[model samples]
Target chain A: MLRRIFALMLKEFLALLKDKRSRFVLIIPPLVQLMVFGYAATFDLKHVTYAVFNEDKGSISRDMIAAFHGSPSFQEMPQIERNEQIAVMLDRKTVQMIIHVGPRFTADMLSGRPAPIQIMVDGRNSNTALLIVNYAQDIVNRFNNDWVAGNGGAPPAHIVTRAWFNPNLESRWFFLPGIVGLLTLLVTILVTALSVAREREQGTFDQLLVTPLHPAEILIGKALPGFLIGIGEASLIVMVTVFWFKVPLLGSLLTLYTGVLLFLLSAVGIGLMISSLAVTQQQGMLGAFFFMVPAIILSGFATPIRNMPALVQDLTLLNPMRYFLVVLRGVFLEGTPFHLLIPQFWPLAVIGVVTLAIAGWLFRHRLY
Target chain B: MNNAQMRLLGLIRKEFLQIVRDPSSIAIAFLMPVVLLLLFGYGVSLDSEHVPLGLVVEQPDADTASFTASFGNSRYFSSVPFRNTPEAVDAMMAGRINAVIVLRQDFARRLRQTDGAPIQLVVNGVDANTARIVEGYVTGAWGKWLEHTALQQGQTLNTPVEIVNRVWYNEELESRNFLVPGLIAVIMTLIGALLTAMVMAREWERGTMEALMVTPLAMREVILGKLIPYFILGMGGLALSVAMALWLFHVPLRGSVWLLFATSALFLLTALGMGLLISTVARSQFIAGQLAIITTFLPAFLLSGFIFDINSMPPFVQAITHVIAARYYVAILQTIFLVGNEWSVILPNALALVLLATLFLGLTRLKARKRLE
Candidate 1:
């Protein structure tokens, strides 16, 4: 029985890798995605194009404009001559923000009253707008510190921040492991989701049914390729994440591997369940995506689950990707211990077993 | 009817009948976009709110109480009190809290003696974006508390420069305002590419292509036959998504409706042309679907500035965004909806769409002629 399943698994592997297109699909796209998305997925804002509408011609205002010129987050657009240009530039999104330094003339500040600096920003992409605001605020705070220290008054109260897991707060460290789970799931689901459906479409399911493989054996045979492929794909991504991206692998290899194993089991189970229900490869493809998009969104991979509506948050409880994400980030960033990750591990195990059982039942019931 | 037009009509009818029989195409076009839009509009948010923060104040005093109350009153965090730093650290490691704030024993004494007191902030940096926001919120809260304390004591704080913010376009900065519009590009890509590409590839796989080639119909008729019905179907999908964005989600549409429709049609052609190009390359439905996903769909999601900022992206990746059709479409859609009919943004992106549509359709035509010969 084991030998028969092994032979079936070998055939499946060959079928996926033997084709030039399939081989290209397996290796090239994941790497391209990993690299492109790794760089593109950062929340840190830069090259924030803004036209400086400086109203003040004072020395202090000169220093402030100079400070704006130096910030790495900001890039100065060609100076706008009239106020109408601000509207036109912002409306066309040629510039994301416009810094309107009020015409304080340095009179308020040198005389001990606070001068107001108005920041006008295009809020189309609100998160980016917010980050830009924060950065601009930093520049103002630094300027205030210098002006006060030079003039002999004390600086205001400030908090000293020390980030625990990532000292520099590089977003790549946060998003890379999440992408490993995401792309690994994508490849795994596509591989298994199409396996049985391909056989059905090509009139090979009947041929397989008569080959003395029991229903359980057929299910295992169908699942092994996805499971093995998922593991191989995940390991390669994990390596690329650590070595290529330089994201630290803070936890034990034993803990990470345990997570990879359980995560792949659940992924394969979900894939097989989709395969069991699909009649054609197209249906399989569609079904995989139908499950995938919501899974990725709800998994707290890109956005935090806590931010989701309570009903939607409850809905995320059923998603295996959610559990795997915690394990991935925890192990990669937090160096979370084995026992600490057990809560995440058991849910994936539960989801894997339940899904596999459902797939088995669907296969038997769908069969004659 | 003329000979060529008659042949194309017959082929289009057949495609329509096939789509009617298969509900999956309709599902992909209309249903999937609704689900995705609902999720993006309602479920996902970048505005940090109600973050669980661990607060540990040793030897609590009036200063600590007021500071703690300041954090409690702020809308950003829901504070979880920990008895000590170790307890807070344990909670952070367990993922129960996102960050920890510790006020030492001499919290009040230091503030009176010195101008700036040190407040220790330990943030779980696993999610850097959230951590950054959390830090900002904490700083804002601390600053607010200090000003209040200084005012009550009849002392003016030395705040040299005050910041006054004015946010334009999306004044509230709801992520939904832009995401819903950008989503139209993604939804249109799936409907345009998946519908035509897989259907064209299926004909080849099922031996219908050989039957069709044996007919007196020209290859031009065949390509047009494939393009027309799916084009209409994809347009219908876009109209439905636009309606949802405008009315259901209450996302304000600021541009001319006619302009929106015209540019969307151009973008749809670009997407459908991509479908034809993929069918030419991979003649199997399986490969066609995979290729469409890898080339068209994923680029639409990541590289299109749908969620990620293009300016923030590295130079090499930003250069690649030029080739992605959805990038231009997203620009056009966001500009039209959020900003207005700014032809400066629209015309260039529309021209890019035209060029890409022409390039893809020309490539498909060349490849199809070769394969047919």
Candidate 2:
């Protein structure tokens, strides 16, 4: 029985690699998606487009405008002559914001009076808009600080900000660890999910049933390949993330790998369940996506799980990916010790056992 | 009717019958949009609320109590007072709290002095997006609290420059408004690609393509027959999505319904053409499905300006988005949904969608012929 299952595993590998497209599917998409997600899946804005309606032509106002000009974050658009242009340009999305330096100019500030500067912003994507406001506010605060110093009236208070995990707060540090779990889940689920459905559709399952092997042996043979591939894919992505992306892997590799191993087991189990449920490969594919989409969304991969509604937040408890994301980010960034990571580890193990048990029952019954 | 028309009609009937038999296509078309829309609309939010913030105050003073009270009253933070900084930092490391604020023993003492007081804030920046938001909210809350405290003390704070920030379009600043509209493009891309590509590739993999090629019917007629039913199914999804966006999610439709449908029809044709091209290249459903996912679905999800900001990406990646059909479609969808008939935004993207549809369909035609060779 052991030799037969081993032979079946070899046959699975041979079948997957024999097709050039499947080979490409197994290798290229993950790498390409890794690169894409690493670069494109960021919320940080490097360049902000804004038009200046600086009615105040004072030396101080120019000095303030000069501050914005010097910063790499701000890219000054073509000058808007009238207030009307702000609307038109904003409507066309030619500029993300319009910095309207009021006509009062530097007159109010030098005389120890409060002056107002209006920043007309496009709030289409509220996060980007808010970030733009924050960046602008930083520049203005510097200007105000200088004014306070020169006037010999020191500012009331200052914030001493320290970021613990990611010093520069680079978004690359945040998303790379996430892609490791997400892509691993995608590949493992697709591989295991497609195999049984494909064999069933091709009427090869009956031939296997007629053999001396039990359904349990066939299941192990089928699941081992997906588990192996998932581990290999995850390790490759992590290596690339650390070496190529220069994202520091602060925690021990042993800790991270332990999570990866347990996570793959759960992913493989879920995939087998989908495989048992699907009648055709297409149905299998759909089932995989059905699990993956919600799994990913609720995982706090891109969006925070805390921000989700109370019920949805509770729903994420059932997802294995959520715990894995925490493990990945915690290990990569926080250098979280193994003991601290236990809360994330056990859920994946539990999910793995539960799903595999159901898959076994489904396979034995050949139930859809 | 002519023989060619009769053949095309017969093929169309077969495609429709196959769709009826296969429930997955229906699920892909209708059920998928509902699931995707609801998930994106409700589950995914960029807004940061209820961020767990830890406060570590060394000595409790009247001023410190008021400051902590202000923080407690703020909607942005759910503050927990830790015994000390070490506990707060430990909680931050454990992922229980994202930020820690420490007030030294002299927090109230130095506030009235010339050099003012200093408070320490340490944030867990592993999730940079949330960190940036948390930092911004913390700053805003601090500023408001200072102003309120100053007013109560009957001391007018020496105000320098006041910023009047005016936000136009999406005044409520809900990420859902934009995220929902952009998601429609992704849903349509999946429907058009998976339904058309997988079905056609199945015909080839099953050796029915060789059989169909031996017939007197032209390949163009067969292609047309394949395209129409899926096109109708895709449009059905489009209609259902827009209706849900309006009634269910309450997303405002600022543009004309006819114009929205018309442009969507153009974008759907582009997506369908890409699907046909993939199927023609990959004669097996397995390869076709994977290829469709690699070329169309993932790129549409990421590079299409759906969720991620296009301008924030590297210059090269931003340029790569120009070729993605969903990029144009997302721009069109967001414009039609939020900005109304902003022709300058709509026209160029629509024109690109038109060109892309022609390119993909023309390539599909070139790659495909009646011959099995």
Candidate 3:
């Protein structure tokens, strides 16, 4: 049985890696994706275009616009005149925000009254709008404090906030760790899900069924190749993340690998189950995607799980990718110890056992 | 009808029958949009609310009580009180709280004597976006407390720059308002590409291409026959997603429905042409599917300005997104759904779609002619 499984693993490797195009598919896309997504997937705002309509030509208003000009986060578009240009600028997608200072701006501040400055934000992309508002708020808050200090006294209270793990709050530190899990999922699911269905479509499954191999042996042979590929893919991504991307690995390599192995088990089990159910390679491809898309979205890789609705949040408890994401981010960012990660590890183990058992049973039943 | 038209009609009917007979194709065509729309609508949200925070007040004086009350009163924070800083830090490490607020021993003394009293905020910066949001909310809460205290003393606090924010297009600033439209682009790309990407490859793998080459059918008739069925299926997918976006998810359709349908048609042709082009090149279903995903779906998802802002990306990556059809479609969808008929935005994107469709279909025609020769 051991020899048979080894032979099957060899065959699977040759099938995936023998052809020049298939070899290229296996090696190059992940690297390209890593570089492409590393730069593209960011929430940090830069070169954000804003048009200023300073109705109050006072130094304070001018100072406010000057502050935006000095900051790297914003770019000032060519100044606009008519009230109509505000709508036109926003509609043209040329500007993300329109800063309009009211007429009573400086007088209200000098007389110690609340002066209103209307900021028309392009809310088409609400995340960018939120960040822009925060930037504007920070600039205004600083100006207010300086003015008050010049007059008589500063504010009596202020919060000195500091981010713990990521000081500058670089988005790269957050997303690169998550990319390790995503790339692993893409490779593992494709490798395992297509194995059995491809054999069936090519009329080789019947010959395999007539062999002396037991169902458990067949399952191991089918799953081991994908398992090794997933581990290799994960290791490559981790190396690139640490050395190339310069994200520090604070945790034990053992802890990270343990989590990855368990994750691969569950991921490979899912692929095998889809393979067992599919009659054709196309069906298997679609089935794999049907499961993979929702898994990634609900996993808190890009969007936070807490932001999901309650029922969907509860539904995420069953998703292996969700637990793996927590493990991946925690192990990379927080240096979380193994004992602290047991809760996540056990659920992944449970999913792996259940899915593998189901796939084994279905393979046996179909063969009989 | 002429014999060529009759042959084309027969081929389209046969493709339709094959699509209906295959459960996976039907599922990909009909069920995928529902799953993706609901998933995107409910699952993906940028609104960060009800963040859990830990509060450590060393001295519980009147000022401390009021200061803590501001965090507790606001809808954004759910503040839990801890006796000391150690306990709060433990909770933060265990992931129970995203941030901790520590009030020092001289809390009230500094408020009365010093010009600026210091309060410390330590945030879990694992998720940087959330941490930034927490900082912003904390500042807002602090400012409100100061304002409330000044009003009580009957002394007007001068805030020189008061911001009155007006969020246009989506006044409430819901993420779904734009996310729902972006979801349409993603769904169309997957369904169109995954569906037709395998058709020509499957024929080759099954040796039916050799059989079909022996017949009198023209290459143009075959390509058109393959595209017409999936085009209808892709259109059906668009209609389903748009209806769900409008009625189920409550996303406003501010532009003309006919125009939305027209742009969707153009985008679908481009997507289908890309898929058919990939199928013609790959010659096997496995490679075709992999190529479709690598070339079509991943680029559409990452580079299309769907979730991430394209302008924020590096310049080289930004240049790459120019060739992606979904970027234009997403721009068109967001404008049509959120902002009403803004031809300045819609016309440029629609023209790009037209150009991409022409390029892709023209490449596919050239490839098909070579295969026939």
Q: After superposition, how far is residue A258 of candidate 2 from its true place, in Å?
A: 1.3
TM-score of decoy 3: 0.97
For model 2, residues A134-229, the per-residue Cα lDDT tens digits are 778878877877876787866466678888778998887998898888888888875787777777777787687798987778878988999898
Instruction: Please list all clashing residue pairs in model 2, or write none if there are none.
Output: none
Tens digits of per-residue lDDT for model 1, B1-373: 8888788889999988988887788887878888888877788776667899999999898878988888764566899999999989988988889999999887778777656678999999989988888887887787678678778789877578888888888888887887788778887887788777777778788888888998887887888888988888888888888988998889888889999999999999999999898987788777776776667656788789887889999999999899899999998898888878889999999999999999999988877762542
Error of 2 at B125 (Å): 1.1
Q: For model 1, what is the C-alpha lDDT against the true structure?
A: 0.84
Better of 1 and 3 by lDDT: 3
Model 2 spans with C-alpha error above 4 angstroms: B112-114, B145-155
Clashes of 1: 0
- Candidate 1 CAPRI grade: medium
User: Going through the candidates in order, what is the number of backbone clashes in each?
Assistant: 0, 0, 0
Docking class of 2: medium
What is the C-alpha lDDT profile of model 1 across A116-190, one tens digit per residue?
Answer: 888888777776788888888878878887887788766445588999899999888988888888888887876
TM-score of chain B of each: 0.96, 0.95, 0.96
Each model's DockQ? 0.71, 0.68, 0.75
The complex in candidate 1 yields a DockQ of 0.71
Candidate structures ordered by TM-score, highest first = 3, 1, 2
Tens-digit lDDT track of model 2 for B1-373:
9888888889989988988987898998899999989878888887777788999999998888877776754556688889998888889877889899888999888888888888788898998877877777677666667777777879755557777888777778778888888888888988888777776677777788888888887777777888999999999999999999999998888889999999999999999999998898887766776676567556887789877778878898988899899999888887788778999989999999999999988888888877675
The Cα error of candidate 2 at residue B28, in Å, is 0.8
- Output the number of the DockQ-best candidate: 3
